[model samples]
Target: MRSDSMGRQLLPKRIALPIFASDALSSVAYAPDEILLTLALAGSLAALNSVWVGVAVAAVLAVVVISYRQTVHAYPSGGGDYEVVSTNLGKTWGLVVASALLVDYILTVAVSVSSGAAYITTALPSLAGHEAIIAVTLIVILATLNLRGTREAGGAFAIPTYLYMGAIALMVVVGVIEWVTGNLGAAPTAHYDLVATGGHEEGLVGLAGAFLLMRAFSSGCAALTGVEAISNGVPMLRRPKSRNAATTLALLGTIAATMMLSVLVLARQTGVKIVENPASQLTLNGQPAPADLQIAPAISQIASAVFGAGSVFFFIITAVTGLILVLAANTAFNGFPTLASVLSRDAFLPRQMYRRGDRLSYSNGIIVLSAAAIVLVLGFNAQVSRLIQLYVVGVFISFTLSQLGMIRHWNRILRTRQSGEQRGRVLRSRAVNVIGFMMTGLVLIIVFITKFAHGAWITLVMILVVFLIQQGIHRHYETIRSQLRVDDWTAKRTLPTRVRALILVSNFSRPSMRAVAVARASQPSAIELVSVVADETEERRIRSEWEESGIPIRLTLLSSPYRNVIQVILQYVRTRRKRSPSEMLVIYMPQFLVRHWWENALHNQMALRLRRALLGVPGVVITVVPWKLGEDAEVEGHQLVNDPFKRPTTIPSPSSDTLVGPETVEE
Candidate 1:
């Protein structure tokens, strides 16, 4: 739990793979579904294009993984794409990437958790229509685990992630075997006839069909969402962090590509049909499918066809699929906080985000990510179809910018002379980045052009807003630094000419006596016991107690025509400050410190108001002297030296002859 113990939290490749790769790996659950759904708009024959669409998506995923591997090697401080773009492309572009990544990270959590909730409904029909509640609960749980520390979260999530991977792998292997043996069963919905939309009845025949394919490709690119996280998380890995991270990236790319392509291939073989408007587009026996019929996701249908609907393996696959979807949010849990800490260190975010919690994790960023994800979930009602519309836009923005930065990075390296082998390697890296840039850049354009009207514009607007907010935060910090800079050391450190102390007394109590004792101990040039009184009887009682206590300070009463105690005190203090502007006026306020929360309401209302009112006054210091209210409120490991209110018999009295009058404000 100590800061020094952070080294113990370093993750090995096995654990890091699951933690950083879960999001990308889980994309196989829904990316294929998205691809098929988009393709299904053009009829079942057009839906057969799902395999090639997945192939194109996997190719981009491969290039992005390779490009980020280079990124991790070059900039392993864990700033990831933001650092890459900032260091090579400059801070403005860097901030653009940061904002984009921030928005994407939020959408990642929202989309992943929502999709997982959908999977839960796939297996448990009774839980349908409550995806928002389920998704919110999963986010809260992930946030709590991550608050404990990244390593513990990794350990907890590793099993389900691996289980999901294994489930997919098994389904793929079994589906292939069943196909070769000619025993592959058809999906439950395979019997339904799909009707192409009016414009696309011809199915991939013209410019419209090509545009639809591009749209499907963009939707399938969601698999690339979490690939960059490994680069962002190199600091969390063990020794040789970059190499381990790069290796994990390669592993993630291979596994995700394999799972996605295999699922798509198997979906084609098993004739799995998914459509956006299932009630309208699908027909059974020449009749429209029932409006209330629930359509299972592509993966669930594939699992049922390959492993039998009610089999144990079927349940295991669906269960693990749902769990991995939920755990995919863990990737954002790890990356968002780390990225936020970097931004905070750079003064783009609040300094509190840069601080580690007791468990040595960025607790503020995790909680913030959780809250944002929950809001998005509730706002969209936990519908993956809707949330996915806003998903990949930000991530691809970061991707395109990072690859461009990497190319620039290599160019800078090549400007300096290198040996033959080194030059060859650098050129190869640059070439890879170039390919990555073109691929991701093209994908970014396509995604924006295709999805802009379908809620991607919301993401773009959010990114721009985040960018402007960070710029403002940075400007604020810069302004503070400039203003607080000490140009003249002597003048900045010089003490006030005289120290004048005033104790605000309401009645004769131990707390008030303690405040008076503290004021006298300060040995100020002048001291006064001041009271704001509206009632003559109360003033008389306070004067009586002061004389009986034998305190050497002069007692001054300020009369309040109205019972505005705080206003009366403020007027008196401001008038004195106007009279002696160069001296420091220290106001000692006695307050009771209670142990219970409700007890706060019973006390300190006046002290709170007085402190707030005096805060803006120049040359005024409000000092709160807390008197503990309970027996157990003693200072730890030490007893009180003596009773603070035990009045000293030999107190040095002030040179004043008598107490000031109620109208002392005139002087």
Candidate 2:
């Protein structure tokens, strides 16, 4: 049982890197594309600015990564942005950030999986038009891997992540060397002339262009999506968790920024072109390119240019890039559950989210995140460009608020401080947080302004919806707590002076006889055999059997006009309770214990349903007198006595005559 309950396994650092860093790293695959696509609206000149935009994006990513490193060091509790914001800014801000992060994580999975499927379909033409199906399938598979356990999923991702890094690095090096040596040539689509869409063929410059530039920058900010995972996953790190996680964050940032910048530079150097509507906007030598010709992703185009078209190195780069994008969803798998566990601890989410599986991982969180991602993937048809618009808004929202919260946290800490050394440390940390706030706040404004119309509004709406739901959950828990509160007055109040035990009998069988004996032993004020009659023949047979058995207890029969036993019993109990409100009615129900799942089909569940309904009645108590079947009976007393019908030797049977009428019984 323990083994079955355990999570997949413990993840080593090698596996953890790909499992957590894939999102940040895989952004390199589409970061350049997003920049170029956004710039293409302004014609060739605007598109030419992709390299500078890439540089700016890399800079911001570096800052964010550094800021999060500090977060990991200070907190190291695996709460990430939600914890930081809530602890410092207050619960409202914390919940806001939590909602945003939740949506962002879901978008992460949707965007990554869809981008991966798109790349795969591009490489293998036979799989075209099946992008959504393929993307959903992959999501399901990844979810299963995660459900198995975190360590196992991480280990599964390790090789693909390293290969992806190695492939991209190789392409960057080879492309640069080839270009410098004059061996590199144009990409297959390099000569294609892109016709600007809409009326802005001249491309906007100055203020208009500046706005576009910010949009491009915001799009490129996709590179920073997974940087916070380290902060949320500090506990998953090895010894010296904070230090290791901080180091890992730095390494991830450096590598991701390098790859993103490399891809952008290479695309620019090789004259790679990407358009929104490739068939309509892209022309080859002033003629529209054939609709049948597929445009490869930005990274694949660079790989082919560097390694020569159709080369082994080109295929390797393409395969790993595609693989890494799919695995990038793993970062969300790592972050989402940990954050959910934090929210669960705070009562913002269901308590089950905090419980660990056999592997000591938040398995419930994994399932919830996966379900959310699947819905988004299906809703968006697995289109990366469409989904990318919703990507960074949530992340930056949290980033800005968390940094500001950190500032507040530092101020509060400083007020209680005494030592100069401690004060100096606090001041330095406060300085970093201040810088972080300004930087992230700027990026958040840019993201909202640039991406809101493109589809980000939907994401914001989702965040708000989630926020309301969380609030409702908190409210519900509070109401339940209030209702359950037991004060001294309530606790000291009387329970009951007497118990009226009713033995529910189906027939005058050994089981019913045993139930009567137990009920009598309880010494209730009133003891009676209550049986439900569904048909005349069965009722007469039961009555005759009772008389023949010579049981002294008076048998009371209730008619079930609709052939419903539970309803009849419920009505009878209600009538009794109304007559004597002070008396406690203990309904002893006879139940048979049987093995084999199919055995349940042979017996009616009326007793179970009846007990459930009886719970709502005041002054009513329901108890089950379980009659174990032959297979369920334990071997005892060296005889195969029908244990199901026979009373246990440990409990002495009561005399039937003493329990025949109403008489007050001691509590």
Q: Please give the RMSD to the true structure for each candidate, in Å.
A: 2.7, 4.2
Output the number of the TM-score-best candidate.
1
- In candidate 2, what are the lDDT values of residues 1-667, reduced to their tens digit? 2555333344445666777799999999998899988888777777888999988888888778877888888888889888898888889999999999999999999999999999899778899989999998998898888877777777788888888888888888888999899888788778887676775566765677788889999999999899988888888877677888888888899999888888888898898988877778788677787877777888888877887878898888888888888999999988999899989888899999988876566789888988899899889888888999999999999989988988887899899946999999889888888887898899999998988999989999999999999999999888898977877787558778666778888886655655666675576766677888877786778778876766556677887756877778778888888888888889898776676778989988777778788888877888887766673335122232333234456544344533353221111
- Model 1 regions more than 4 Å off: 535-552, 630-667
lDDT of each: 0.89, 0.82
Name every residue pair that clashes in candidate 1: none
The top-ranked prediction according to lDDT is 1
TM-scores vs. true structure, each candidate: 0.94, 0.89
What tens-digit string does per-residue lDDT give for candidate 1 at 98-134?
Answer: 9999999999999999999999988888998899999
RMSD of 2: 4.2
Residue 32 error for model 1, in Å? 0.3
Q: How close is candidate 1 to the true structure, as a TM-score?
A: 0.94
